[model samples]
Target: MKAVIINTSTDSELVSADVVELSNEFNTFAQKTAESILAMGLTVAKAKRLSASDFETFCKLIRYESDSSAIRKLEQIGKRYDALHRHVDKLPSAWTTIYRLCTLDDSAIDASAASGALNPTIKGSDLIALCGAAKSSRGAKNAKSTTARAPADSAVPNGTDMVVRFTTTIDETQIVTLRRVCKLLREVDAEIALSNKLDAVLNQAVEMKEAA
Candidate 1:
């Protein structure tokens, strides 16, 4: 008679293997869902048949109801799809990174692609840094005009502090980008506050004069 062999693996070991398999399956499903959503959003935007209200209603019917801001970003990505399609395979899986890519002009996008910065393996933070670098380069090009207008724009009445306040909503991606900007401003000794509230002390003129 053939000997019966007992399973050597413990129950915990079997469970661990199942967990890893489940995680991989979940990740695959999530990636596919993200791709599908983007494709649907692009189609809707390209069609241009839906009004703002109509889009919201459609989203409800599809159970894809996202906030207006997020919907807007998705639409923007769709609008820029022509310039982006070539790099689709290399683009990061995260929709946030794709949105950030939309923020860049075609030329910058091309440059980033040429530099291999748009690799699928690139992190969202790395993409943000690339966007920041592109923005800084553009800012440098316009620095002279910006500096020329700064004095009048920043003037304040004597013996009184000037505080400008405004409110707007931002997403997680924007928050990360803002934090990076705040860090750079701090490094330049710019008087800026970053918390639940943001306050700018308008010390740019001082910094410019000092630099000159």
Candidate 2:
């Protein structure tokens, strides 16, 4: 059909390179970041991906912001959707959730639709915006930004003892609320229970590193 042709044309240039190679770069970034973020005990559970277009979501999370102010600021930057966030309990901060939404994008609508199917418009920063925008992107909206970044040491010295590495396994609303209060994760907090998970990943990483 004509729509299919348009879908093919959208990319202008299809991904000439292997998708796996493209993913490798992201995987490398994730693993390396794990080392630094994990030091803060900001593992996968407490941390979550955030969506960009949900300005309301960003602002609400920002209002209740905490130690990692940089993350709030990073939300302002742009990238493609499905950018995964390595969320920790109150360490790497909250809005890192937005980052998760950045790296994981999957929107494929009909090309015949007037809104335009197949996300070819997404490229560069605009692409990033798509990731963020996609969060609420009901009509194939891509709201998360998944651009790989090597953030400078935001780790607090001796932070490990004070906090255990944990990722967000907490259930939060897909939509953010305004005038929300930020909750700081206390040492060995029972609610954000990630001690077990953290122990698991750490040992696995060590073994892998040793094997490597």
Candidate 3:
């Protein structure tokens, strides 16, 4: 060509675009690699006979602390991956979302996906809340089933009014302590009633005051 049209600016723009594309590819590859590693670690953990301390050592060697949130979640996923992996593609990128999905069965996972519960608009905590609701519903169903199966031996006698009963929630330690306290209170009340001990103590105090 008689006049060489050298648009250096155009060449520079093309090079910059290529660099951006390459960077994006690298980032994608890195993310995929990280996901694979996490999945592999979870899968191998199933058969590993390592104790808590040994596992912590392994996690440290792998640069993820044993007690780290990420490791804890990955362990949960690993333990239930067989049931969970079927719906993995529908899960959000967050580990929390993945962990929530792991708690559910395939049917629940499919239903949630169909309802778009795992979409970007919904969050991991929202999915966990849904799981909680599902669990409560299941518990209610189980309670109903148990009530329906009550044996004749559990029925109250004809003349005996049903013993006054109320349900209350208590932790294991609280329940144990409450039982012991109730037993002690009953024993003390019986001893006091039999001896008229409280009346005697009050009478003695009044006499001592009059003497003073």
Candidate 4:
């Protein structure tokens, strides 16, 4: 295949051998990075000469912002390097797509790519949806027992106004805090309902001035 280069700065197109050379350079760099990250992860995991528990100290010594962030970067590189380089080599700079793909196992990612579950454009949400759907389908297949429930009575209780149910996503950290908050609220005042607290917060927000 002929190599093509679109020079945005020069307003000229070079279509010959530069494209292939550029692709080769990119692949080499990506492979090196992936290998280095894999080595770093191994080093972190097996710290013979370093303290494993003090991640913050280790990060500072290595010039990283945080240990967790560095570890996640390593994970992303290690998981998606082969797939990204082999299938989506044209867009070597698409870190977002690579990171999204890191959420799934190699088999799930390969299946999604091969089955057209992944869009050509590869939006983050699309990858998330594909991974989630795959996980749900697997869970359904592995489920051994099923429970069937009858439709509940729609009538409200004598003292209650109504019942509300909804679905939403919450971050892991936030959900932990929410559970703690609920537990504390129950322990402090069993009669004070969650709806009451929600209403109170809403009213307070309505009456308060915006933060300057």
For 1-212, candidate 1 gives per-residue lDDT tens digits of: 22222233452222233223322332343343345435644654643344455444444433455466656676787788777776776777777778888878898888888888878788888988999999998788776454343344565455223433347999999999999999997866643334212323346656778999
Ranking by TM-score: 1, 3, 4, 2
Please give the lDDT score for candidate 4.
0.53
Worst 10 residues of 2 by lDDT: 1-10
Off by over 4 Å in 2: 1-41, 44-66, 71-126, 132-136, 139-212
In model 4, what are the clashing residue pairs, if there are any? none
Strongest candidate by lDDT = 1
- Model 1 residue runs over 4 Å out of place are 1-38, 144-212
Per-residue alpha-carbon lDDT of candidate 2 for residues 66-151, written as tens digits (9 for 90 to 100): 33454333433222212222222211222343343335343311211224321323334543454445544543422222222324
By TM-score, the better pick of 2 and 4 is 4
What would the per-residue lDDT of candidate 4 be over residues 74-172, giving only the tens digit for each residue? 545544556644445222234445565666676776777677666446666776787788788778865522332223655544434334334789899
In angstroms, the error of model 2 at 207 is: 67
lDDT of 2 at 78: 29
Off by over 4 Å in 4: 1-63, 66-71, 90-93, 144-212
lDDT of 3 by residue, 1-212 (tens): 12122234335222233223322332343343324434643543542345454444344334566567766676676777665555556556655666666677666666777777756446766887978866777789876665453454676554333443358888999999999999999999999797897789999999999999
> lDDT of model 4 at residue 202?
90
In model 3, residue pairs whose N, Cα or C atoms come closer than 3 Å (at least 3 residues apart or on different chains), thus clashing, are none
* CA deviation > 4 Å runs, candidate 3: 1-41, 51-54, 105-107, 119-121, 150-212
Rank the models by lDDT, top first: 1, 3, 4, 2
C-alpha TM-score for every candidate: 0.49, 0.18, 0.47, 0.37
Go through the candidates in order and give the C-alpha RMSD of each one to the true structure: 20.9, 26.2, 18.9, 18.4
User: Which residue pairs clash within candidate 1?
Assistant: none
